[model samples]
Target: MAGIFVYAETKEGEFRKATGEILSRCRGVADATGEPLVAVVVGPAPEDAPRRLAPFGADLVLHVEGPGLEVYTSQGYAWAVTSCLAGRQPAALFFGNTPLARDLAPRVAERMDAALHADCTGLAWEDGRFVFTRPLYGGKLLARAVSRPGHPVLATFRPNSLGVAEVAATSPAYERVQVEVPAGSVASVVKETIRQVAGRVSLQEAEIIVSGGRGVGGPEGFRVIEELADVLGAAVGASRAAVDAGWISYDHQVGQTGKAVSPNLYIACGISGAIQHLAGMSSARCIVAINKDPDAYIFKVADYGIVGDLFQVVPALTAELREMLVRA
Candidate 1:
């Protein structure tokens, strides 16, 4: 069958936020092309997974279940996705530009001899072609690309870069495809998975982020940042300088060398906002910078700037937000 296929990524048995973001974007393309929206899942099926995908406009869900699939192995996931493509070809295959997708999408495209585009922030069907837009030169520019005709197009989207559709009560139809892992196909075994236990939101998936930098002083300084983030239900982020100083773990770092995030609201506390740092979060919908230095480069890109010591300002703001939230 000719349709649109989306790789629904999951983490620890729950759907990743990127799954809904990609599906919502693909839904528009499917509607335009007059094709069914097929969501493919490779792993132990989560209860009500298909029903959850329906709200994002998945007309059908293809569940691929098999041994050696519970933990993500590049080879195993690639093989399973290719197996689902055996009897049918999709107009375009979509995957989130996540770590797993980064490894699996290229492999699947290579197996199918299809064209692939990575880190696409925008996708559109124009003039009978699927045009994908992705950032280049550290997000200094956006480049548009399209695949050759007569080949299945493949693309991976950055998380939170696209919008998510509202949830619906209706459930999509489901189909189960049993995959047989070929001998010698499975190479690595996942011994253990250590999950990060922190704020409610994952940095990549967070809508609001409160980030600190070297100006925060020391490890103890992060408490203020965390308190503000907690009150706002935002994720805690750190500049590369903070991580390098050992004030926080590298996982909290956000810069060219670290994670790129595009949250709805990015509160940069005490960050000088170097070009490298901006490269990672310049795409945020709104940027708020709090720094004592009015000359801080971060203020240049901030939608709102507050010149003050973050220590006092952050606590005051957190207290105000708490009171307002309580009153509401």
Candidate 2:
């Protein structure tokens, strides 16, 4: 079938926000191109995967199930994606420009000898053609890429590039395809998956994030930011400077070289806005910058700026918000 294909990435048997984010946009494109919107999940799929995904404009959900597919092995998962595309011509295969997609999309593209557009900030059908826009020169410029309409196109979409919203509802049908993976098929095997910061909301999926930077002074300084995050139910982020200083783990770092995040709100405390850092979070809907330096670069991009010591401002802000939440 010549249709739109989406990789449904789920965590703990539930769909990740990125899955819905990409599907919601592709749903519109599917309507415009008159192509069926298909979703593919590789792993132990949730029982309600189809029902939950149908509203996002999925006409069909392909649940690829089999042994050696329970954990994410590059070769195994890549094979699963290829199996879905076999015997069918997909107008385009969409993957979130995430770590997994970054690793997996290219493999599929190479196997099929397809044109792969990586790190697309925008993917849309324009002037009756598929236009993929990506950042160039360290995000200094955006280049739009267009390809011939008929051939299979592969693209990786950035998270939060386009806001997520659902389309008209439908009862999506499902097909379970089994592909057996023999041992030694993949170069590496994952024996166990460990969870770090398991209870905390993930930085990428968070709607609000409270981040600290070099100005936090030390690891202990992150406590105030954590207090703010805990009260707001926001994830804690760190600048590369702070991460290098050992004030926080690299997992919390948000920058071009780190994780790209698009949250509803981003609170940068004691961070001097560098372009590298901005590339990751500039897409946030509402940015609040707190710094003692009045001329800090972060203020330029923040929706709200506070020229004050974060040590003082963050605690007071956290206290006030805590009170408000308690009152409510």
* For every candidate, C-alpha RMSD to the true structure in Å: 1.7, 1.6
Runs of candidate 1 exceeding 4 Å displacement: 166-170
**Model 1 worst lDDT window (10 residues):** 162-171
lDDT of 1 by residue, 44-136 (tens): 768788878877888889999987787789899899999888879787888987778989999999998888998877777787688898888
Position 137, candidate 2: lDDT: 61
Consecutive 10-residue window with the lowest summed lDDT within model 2: 157-166
Instruction: Report the C-alpha lDDT of model 2 over 1-328, residue by residue, as the tens digit.
Output: 3888988887778887777777888887888778888899999889988899977878899999898898888899998789768878887888887778889999998876789998777777787678988877656688999967778888888777766765887678899989887677799968888787778988887899999999999999999999999999999999999999988989999998898887899999999999999888887889999999999999999999999999999999999999999999
Candidate 1 — what's its lDDT?
0.87
TM-score of each: 0.95, 0.95
